[model samples]
Target: MTPSRFLRSALAGLLLAAGTAGAVPTASVPEFSDWPAGTAPAEVGRRVAENFAARSFQWQTDPKRRYVIYPEICAWYGALTVAGLSGDTALRDRLYAKYDVLLTPEGAARVSPDAHVDYRIFGVVPLEFQVQGRGDAWRAIGLTYADAQWGNPVIADGVSPEARWWIDDMYMLPILQVQAYRASRQAKYLDRAALTMAAYLDKLQQPNGLFLHAPDSPFYWGRGNGWVAAGMAELLRDLPADHPHHARILAGYRAMMAALLPVQGTDGLWKQLVDKPESWGETSATGMFTFALVTGVKSGWLNAKDYAPAARRAWLALVAHLDDDANLAEVCVGTDKARKTTKSDDLKVQYDFYQARPRRSGDLHGQAPVLWTASALLR
Candidate 1:
């Protein structure tokens, strides 16, 4: 079945369970009729999806890694999502065909063997294929990564051995497990994701509601917090309200959203160092935050009257950064959290490191969130 069909069946099941047709809950999809001329969700979604479809598989260029990196996997997942949400069968088929290559021996070689958070996140693509009515093979391949993440005998504080308390894991870990739950309807996957998020919240979330890059790294790095926002929003979309961790996760998400409201650039972008006025506006973070806000408003976690305009403004501003080729500009290059040293000058060095990072166009980090935002708008 197509994604639209799957959605309809899911909704039908929900309605049947409610025992009254009038009691059914539905998510509202915002119409693009009133959006700016060129920034409509459909237009931008199609452009980015086509750009992705036309590209060759991307691998890590630095250190010359052999496997496909997480950013490309993320972009691929987003394209698949927008394809399904928009009911673009041709785009859907094209994406599936691309994924089919990875199932082959030659293509499997491109998949990483490591269990690092970045590598494990590749599972999200195949699990997404499974959600769209693909075969069990996709689920099997996807679950191997998800299950292995917890395979270590020494999990600490209910967190995965892979957990490093880096804010990026906020999105990396939970999204994979959540997709696992969606495919299998297994409580373990959801439990793992929810418990892990709660732990991260306790470790990293700040009084200002944004996350630091790490517990010791004091600055609010834009993409790092973006990961937190997107991850929470994705988990909430599927997490049952009665679940033990739901309220905590919801409170964390709302707090982050409230914090973001005041910092959005007048141009609708957010800066690389989110709290620093002098930091350059960054595309990837803006896109990720837009997805979070759009998801929140649609899910009624946030009031439309309060968040809808911000979401719309963000989408328009982000699309304006996309070049004719559909590549987003002013994206901060891939960043690693700074390690605190004994030197007293360390904090300033770390802060300058973020401020001085190179801005590139067409990075998968930037590309992925634009597709994510589009998918959220359509969802």
Candidate 2:
């Protein structure tokens, strides 16, 4: 079904609210047509991309910490490589150095139990570099990282390999698996990659449609589901139509997406609690979903005209949150939803700490979302 175009309905209201407050002369949405060329899509994306890039650093590492294996760094690299292609070779070089730590002679990563599951590094990075259309080396750094981390199998610190969570296995690992599968034409890597999500797919179900994190975890962290959705978006490159599981994978993606449609907030963005509806609006998750849903529809895995408006509305809502520098604001920082049991990072965040906090427009964890959102807007 065709969706209706969004009326610039919120523009006048927002402008009026700003007028009485003696704020900067805010323009109505209708006046968006009259705005200078500086606020175009490419420019905003460029600005946010620049802001996100500046924060892009070695995760958990500084000049003082020295270098070490970090999964979050790989996540950063997966998106960073695409971004740096235009001019950020310096940032790309930083990722290349990190990838160098994991690549093995066997053409796969050498992940250790030293860190978490960052399995999808393979599908996103190219292991073998061709020299002017010659010399393709199938040495896979993304896969090698996965193995090195999983090989040692850490269980004592807090989590264990047997303690399976779905999203990481589904999205992070499959990206690399598909990348390897395409390069080697080996069914084994693809098979293992396909199996990674089985546990999660089998276990994930919410009465309203959004997939829950794990069997025991009920709170549906928006970004958690975003990872799964984005991974599915990336998987289209490798999975063939006749592959045994292709149909099922698509089915699962739609089921998860269907769960998202009903919960979009009136402002055109999703709430912090996707299923909870009443939770405050959150940009990181909303932006991610907006990216996935739009990309999914464009890919034909979802219906475009029907869903893109929500994406557009959410995107329009998202546009309003930017600062003069085009940087984003009010995104939630990283937190583990599984740690709901104790007074961990959650309750310890006292108002004393909150109220006295430095005034800022961005958070560390919002980097990926900004990157991801720019990708969506640019598309």
Candidate 3:
């Protein structure tokens, strides 16, 4: 059934199940009216980045939660990148101060060997520190994270050549792999990055060029796909022209961009469920997709005329969501996999679920990508 029909049916079903006609409260969802004019993409990016960087870098989470959380870690990366872009040394130093505890010998020791991959994302920060001539502690943590990933158990999926397929792996794994290669000049690091990414696309990428969140869970959650796009963009930036995976990765990146072009909302943002237009426009995914497209155009991997306009539109759309305080609106909080079963009675993620997911302002997931997008547009 068409998305609208399915949505109407789902809402009707929900109302019936509640045994009430008008009990469920509803709000008039706003649409993207018109985009702001004349602001350069880089400037728009700086506004978002500076607003984030100038803050205390605190998200009101528990102090203990600061050490290895993905959203916080990723947002710091964004702020750091923006500092590099805007030459905001004070902002950069503030970030270092905020996250300094994690860089200590004690903090490095806190990186548990058995920790899940999400925790290892902080490794990329240490690698960045090492590049700036910081002590070996950072490099040690990064390499350890890489080793754990290399030794991670492979799961059986008929199409994947290596381990299990998770869309989040796209962003989760690549930076460390690339940074490892940068630090060691080793092909193996690059090889692992490429092979796993290839395996993911092999199994999860749809014929139309978008990806399902996972092999078993077929939903295309917006941020999940954003991770893939943003991750591929990172990998492509570091991947060598002569490498075996270059052509395929380039093709996959371009294919995903092509798929995204036709679906951009009139407001220049993408829906929470990218393929589901009836869903609300999501800021984080929109920023990531904009960053990827702009990166592709900057790298000459995509036709400038064809892709740049859309990238600009998406960037402008993203800009509209950024409040004067620099908080991003309509960012979906961290999500888990939806049910895999195809039972007809299943309440699949449609308009309501996507819309109902929390809309927090200044979320790092939303914060980080605007920096990436700005950095991409800077070029």
Best prediction by TM-score: 1
Cα lDDT, all candidates: 0.83, 0.51, 0.69
> Across residues 84-181, which tens digit of lDDT does each residue of candidate 1 receive?
99999999899988876777897789898887999999999889999999889899989998999988724457767888778899999999999999
lDDT for model 2 comes to 0.51
lDDT for each residue of candidate 2 in 1-379, tens digit (9 for 90 to 100): 1111111122223322322111112121232224244544445555655554454334234545332232344335334533443344554555444445445542222333334444324324444221111124434443464344335443453222533566645566665555556556677656655555443454454434466554445567666777777666556535665666555555556666767888888987675556666566777677678767755655545555466667667766767777776656757554445534333344333212222223235653444554555554444
Best by lDDT: 1
Q: Once model 1 is optimally superposed onto the true structure by TM-score, how far is the C-alpha of residue 160 displaced, in angstroms?
A: 1.5
Over the full model, what C-alpha lDDT does candidate 1 score relative to the true structure?
A: 0.83
Best first by TM-score, ranked: 1, 3, 2
User: On a 0 to 100 scale, what is the lDDT of residue 128 in model 1?
Assistant: 93
RMSD of 1: 8.5
Clash count, predicted structure 1: 0
Evaluate residue 87 in candidate 2 and report its C-alpha lDDT on the 0 to 100 scale: 44
Native-to-model Cα distance after best TM-score fit, residue 226 in candidate 2, in Å: 1.9
> Whole-model lDDT for model 3 versus the true structure?
0.69
